[model samples]
Target: MPHKRAKRSIRDAETAKKGHNLAPQASTYDDTPRSASRIFNAHAVQSAFRKAGRITSEDTGERKPKPSSSTNTSSSSSSSKLKPQNGSSSSTTPTTKQTDPKKPAIPSILPNESLGEYNRRVEEFLRPGVSKAIKEAASIKAAEEAAFRREKKDRKKRTRIERLVKLGKMPQAALDELDKEMKNKAGKRKRGDEDEGSGSDDNDDDGDKTTTKPREREEKSFKPIEAPRRLNDIVQAPPSLPHLRKLGQEKKVGKGVYGAVGKGSGKDPLNAGQRRILEEERERVVKMYRDMKAAREEAKVEEKGAKVKVKV
Candidate 1:
């Protein structure tokens, strides 16, 4: 009986201790609130509030109620101020002006204005010199023409004189007279010769007979003699005295005879000094010849002496 009582007391003490631990735990849990919303789905709750009109969507087109008339008046006043600033800048900065399309940009200068002025200035600068040169040239040409004409006249006169001299047709005095007469009669003689045809009948008959003669006889009769032969023959003949006088102002030899000497000689001619030198040289040559002859004779004598000695 004592053992059963001890066991029942132990079981009762264990049941009380268990009740004490459960009561505190049940009170702490019961005292805390059940949160009612999730922490992670906060955006979904906020979107639901927005759709319900509790939150406003400013950027999106979920139309909010329109603003009052006072707000619109303030915005219009700001825009009008900005428009005046742009208009003032456009008015102050000017546009570039257009140029004329038809006209060329470079200007033209006239030839008559520039070139004419240059030509006039050049002419003024050179006029005096050019005129002086022209005058000098004219004077020189006139002098040349006058000289040419004088030379021609002198040559003609000389030829006429020489022809007359060769023909033995004129003395000095007669030559001057004949020249004047010929000058006067020249036109008349030319006309007469043209009209004469063959010449007078008697002259023609004589000419025919002359032509029929041997050509050699005709040539011999008319041909000029060589100067040397003429001088030698004429110098010896006495008939040349009158002819020598007609040579006038010419140096004469042996009274009215022209001695041929120097340039005038028919054979060898000499000036006074040349003639003297020649005579001296000739004398020296003759002396040399005599000396040579004497030397040859001496040599011949020496040879004969050598031959006699050899014989001995």
Candidate 2:
């Protein structure tokens, strides 16, 4: 049992040592050999750094570094080794670098031959179809403009016709004739008057005498017609109503009525019989109005002028 226990203790110590060597350790400020080894190993543990380099190479494929002859040789060898399994290879050859011209030449104001050729090509590409479209559009626009002008002219003509119609003038068909006649008559009359004024003495005297004879004849033929007198003028005075006077009263009469002293006399406007008849007539008028109202209510009649239709 002692021997077995001693062996087991030796095995545990060896296992612990291996674990200590393999496990990651926290870093601290120390330069001990063990710590130094730990730091070195930590840096060295980036074994996949080659993958990052390859990824960079893949991303920037075939880009040549500055080609010193020495570098060229080394890169050629390295590139050959790193050649892709897909049979693709990166170039190690140096590219010829173009130096920018010392002064950039000023562009010509006029197009160069190449620019002219390019322009011609573009124009040739668009010419047939674009020109046809443009012409068709212009033609349509012209037609529309012409139609608009025609419509405008027609509208003006219609307005002129309407104006003439309203003024009770000749219709459009006769307007030109009427205008021409009026112009001709005005011209003729003006010329005739001018001739009459500027004619030789004998002709002017004859013209004046002829015009004066017509004036004399017109005055001689004129006769005034008598106008009938108005009824108001003929009467001259307003008619008077019958006088009413009260008993024992003397009253001066006016145009309308007299005092109550004349009442019931033969000369009174209303004698006793006439006064009774007037009272009966007043009652009849009142009864008639009442009967008319009752008849309207019985017939369920509304007032005649109440309802009216309104236009919206």
lDDT of candidate 2 over 56-133, digit per residue (tens): 456545333333454667676665543333432333332323245753332332334587776676567557778989
* Cα lDDT, model 2, residue 19: 77
lDDT tens per residue, model 1, 1-312:
665556777879988877655544434344333454454567798889878876343434243233334567777555343231233443442232224665322223334559667657657756787898899899879968976786578668768887887788866776676567756665675577667746676677798577665557543456776657354443555554444445458653432234544444454655789999999999999999999999999999999999999999
- How many pairs collide in each candidate, listed in order? 0, 9
Q: Identify the candidate with maximal TM-score.
A: 2
lDDT of each: 0.64, 0.64
Q: List the residue pairs that clash in candidate 2.
A: 244-259, 245-259, 245-260, 245-261, 245-262, 246-260, 246-261, 246-262, 247-261
Give TM per candidate: 0.20, 0.21
Show where candidate 1 strays beyond 4 Å. 1-113, 171-312
